[model samples]
Target: MSEEKDLFQIKSCGGRKEADEIKKLLEQNDISAEVKEREKDFVVLVPNSEDIVNEALVIITSQEVYDEFYAGE
Candidate 1:
């Protein structure tokens, strides 16, 4: 038997504000996203890969989505 492992890491630093902001932005654009991982000093948003549908979730997404996240900032 083999265990599962993530291909990449979505790092989030600074604070939760960035993570929350990113989520709201991606959702608004209709780009499915989620918080994949989180740490005391940072948060991680790993995008959904075709390999794993309900497994590896997403954090931040496309350029448009990213733009929206920092729309005001």
Candidate 2:
């Protein structure tokens, strides 16, 4: 079988919880993603494809906005 393709970092989150939330959002949108903890930061990773990476970024940005807005309530 062929080797598994590498995942590229698309976003850096503050912590594991935030990274997991973003990863879950990406998966919910049918885009595969994973979270990697790098020292004090969490990095979100997705397949090394341009289209998927762009889509994931859009979704992550939207979710972050929504979260920030609602978090103030």
lDDT of 1 by residue, 1-73 (tens): 0212432344465776776666566567554445444446545444445533333333334544667879969
Measured over all alpha carbons after superposition, the RMSD of each candidate to the real structure, in angstroms, is 6.7, 2.8
Q: What's model 1's lDDT at 21?
A: 68
lDDT of 2 by residue, 1-73 (tens): 1223667788998989988988888899999887778998999889888999889888988988998999999
What are the models' TM-scores?
0.42, 0.80
Ten contiguous residues with the weakest lDDT in model 1: 1-10
Model 2, CA-based lDDT: 0.85
Clashing pairs in 2: none
Model 1 pairs whose backbones collide: 45-59, 46-58, 47-58
